[model samples]
Target: MNNSNTAFELTIVVPVFNEEDNLERVKQEFDSYLSKSPYRSKVLFVNDGSSDNSQMFIESICKSSNKYSYLQLSNNMGLSAALKAGIDYANTEFVGYIDSDLQTTPFDFDLLMEYRHDYALVTGVRQNRKDSFVKNMSSKIANGFRRYMTKDTAEDTGCPLKIMKTDYAKKIPFFTGMHRFIPALIMLQDGKIKQVPVQHFPRIAGEAKYHLFNRMIGPFKDCFAYRWMKKRYINYEIINQG
Candidate 1:
């Protein structure tokens, strides 16, 4: 474990996949956030084998700022894999996650941070989403179905902004769509979750990764998988240890 006094209390993982155009703005946004963050925080960019120049930009940004570091995957394993890799590498007390597209602001992390001590996970619920009709509606349908299946009670599980205790996050079982079920996974461990309203924006650069089909169908299937895992998840506490 990293010494709390010396290392950052939180590390925000920014998972990147062909986000070349968004890298510069991402650096500026996170840099500004760190300057004003209440908790000592740093950014960790996880490159999921971006085929574009995204890795170059990530390297440049990391070199220019000590607040930034990164992990590069050998191939594109998708968001869940990248997130799991980031959480596995994180050594801070708390770990945060945000998209590189900047749909959710890094500034709102303050709101989530305020409740970090009270819950295992603090996730954002985007208020007044600025996405297309299809995207928004599909997400709503998916979220509703997911809530019914998992009973996680998360209003907006698709929200990209979230803060999680490193211990709980590291314990989450990783799956193909694990990123979409963070709150549910935390709940499976008997941990609490808090959701706060946050700002949302339209994509400034690069393309949206998921479309209606994947957004809806992928989550629909994964919800069942979560149900299967929930039934068998094991939890135990040790009373004595040598």
Candidate 2:
């Protein structure tokens, strides 16, 4: 219920887990990016109940910078919950998202924001994914199946960069793997979503957080959910004046 007033022009949500090593680098990257971005943007860090020193690092970053801010859940929530929480609390016209592992460059947001006006959501597709063969192949298989089921056809829904209208992003239902269905969900609501190619880098410090189960099995089940919702999803418009 907080942030009821519209103030920030953009809120960039950074979802973090046990990424203590990458935390400071993430803040500096965003701070440097905000210096040049046309629209003033504030960074929101969501700590997903990390048992590490992630919360302390987030607080230090917030205290050092006025544009930086953060929130920590009582316990670890999944990525979907963390993202939805940020969107719910965001009081900006545009809410952007990126991961804390530093896989994607924060400054690449300029590419997405350029088309922000015409799109309800702007997402990134990694043309040259900087992942291992196993990671890359598994993602491809998952993406293909997801497209067949949900028919969203987003080349890289797994890419960790996006900018969306706060209102539309807030309306998306919070399923466990709903993060993968953002473009599809926006399409279902008759909203426009643009996908742009962005830079991808290898993880520098922390270990790969995703395992085979979460990447392959988790998304498989959620795809079925997306299809089910797609069939029964509600959409209506008022026709005429009284």
Candidate 3:
């Protein structure tokens, strides 16, 4: 890790799994963001035990850029685990998440940062999504169900382009589908969230990790899990500590 990179205020964690084809584009997009971002920023590529050449590409990217680094998971623990690992690893004041696929632009992070001061979480809502009809409808159903269950009011929880304060992010409990409930989790901590419209593009390479079953049934199950956690969640404030 570059010592100077530690001075950054924001760390963007890009979780990767079998996204070897997308690494280069990811690097370029983030590198461009770092050059133009209002806040001092760096990118942390989390390798979620990708069985492809993703690690090789990640290592190469990290080696070539001081603004880039990575964490390698032992195996494919799924998106929630990978996101949690990245959040745990982040030491900056704020952390952001973006998918390895170039569907969302890293540049949109700047828009999220604009509301960073007022909201504990700032996430993107993709405008004019370029996915297939099945993908779009499934996502809409999933989002609607999640909103009804968690009452997070997040239109696009699965947008994948989000920024949140590191402290708030660290407070979230790790679970298989925690990634889908980030805004709700922040709300659990009595934190505020803001959503901004962001540009979305079609995937240029690599296969999507999710399917109809996982997108619909998986989130349906996780919604109940979230409700259970919400009921049992505990929050308190300490006036003083010795």
Candidate 1 lands at a TM-score of 0.97
Residue range 24-52, candidate 3, lDDT tens digits: 88888877778887788888888999999
User: TM-scores of all models?
Assistant: 0.97, 0.94, 0.97
Leading candidate by lDDT = 1
Candidate 2 has which clashing residue pairs, if any?
Answer: none
Write down the lDDT of every candidate, Cα atoms only.
0.92, 0.87, 0.91
Ten-residue region with minimum lDDT total, candidate 3: 1-10
RMSD of 1: 1.8
In model 3, what lDDT does residue 203 have? 97
Query: On residues 1-242, what C-alpha lDDT tens digit does candidate 1 reach at each position?
Result: 22232558888899999999999999888888888877789888999999999999999998886778899999999999999999998888999999999999999999999999999999999999999999999999999999999999999998999999999999999989989999999998889999999999999999999999999899999999999999999976579999
- Clash counts per candidate, in order, are 0, 0, 0
Local lDDT at 74 for model 3: 96
Error of 2 at 108 (Å): 0.9
Model 1, which residues run further than 4 Å from truth? 1-5
